[model samples]
Target: QGTLKYSFNAKDKSAEKTYQCEVDRPDPTDFSINCVGERTKLAIDIDRNLGKSKVYIDLNRFAGERFGFEAVRDPQTKQLD
Candidate 1:
């Protein structure tokens, strides 16, 4: 359980948002995480692709955040670029 308190807009009105997240096994073979919040939820899963070696992320449907793509992981070094 996690609690986050902040103002939603410039009105300075206080608000409290709570969330709960649980992770069972997050290893090389399998990874899963479940998160729930006031009006949003996120489910992340990482698994090997048997047919293709590709990795993708949810941008429109599942993910509602529009965080700019100014930062990315270097494909070769696996570091933040």
Candidate 2:
């Protein structure tokens, strides 16, 4: 138990996702931090949250440059293809 670290749980859900970290008998001097990251969500959220922060985007490049988009389904065929 000298240098053992563990993650207690994780969640993959429809609305949100989360994680947890746990350590056994942590030392008084030991400090820890946990962070959550996402790929597509981060890419999209960056532009959205930045906009809410009173930033300007007069260049009109946030659609593909900042927040990339994907096609979940084809409108014509209604399939993943």
Question: Which of the numbered candidates is closest to the native, going by highest TM-score?
Answer: 1
Backbone clashes in each candidate structure, one number apiece? 0, 0
Candidate 1: regions farther than 4 A off: 1-18, 49-81
lDDT for residue 67 in candidate 2, whole number 0-100: 31
Candidate 1 at 15: error in angstroms?
7.0
**What RMSD does model 2 have?**
18.0
The lDDT, on a scale of 0 to 1, for candidate 2 is 0.29
The superposed Cα distance between candidate 1 and the true structure at residue 28, in angstroms, equals 3.4
How many clashes would you count in candidate 1? Answer: 0
Candidate 1, 6-63: lDDT as tens digits: 3456464556554476665655655555566666654555443221122223344455
Once superposed on the true structure, which residue ranges of model 2 sit more than 4 Å away at CA? 1-13, 19-26, 39-81
TM-score for candidate 2, please give it: 0.18
User: lDDT tens string, model 2, 1-81?
Assistant: 122222334353454543232332244433333222232112111122112111111213334443333334454655643
Model 1 TM-score, 2 decimals: 0.37
Give candidates' CA RMSD values in order.
Answer: 7.5, 18.0
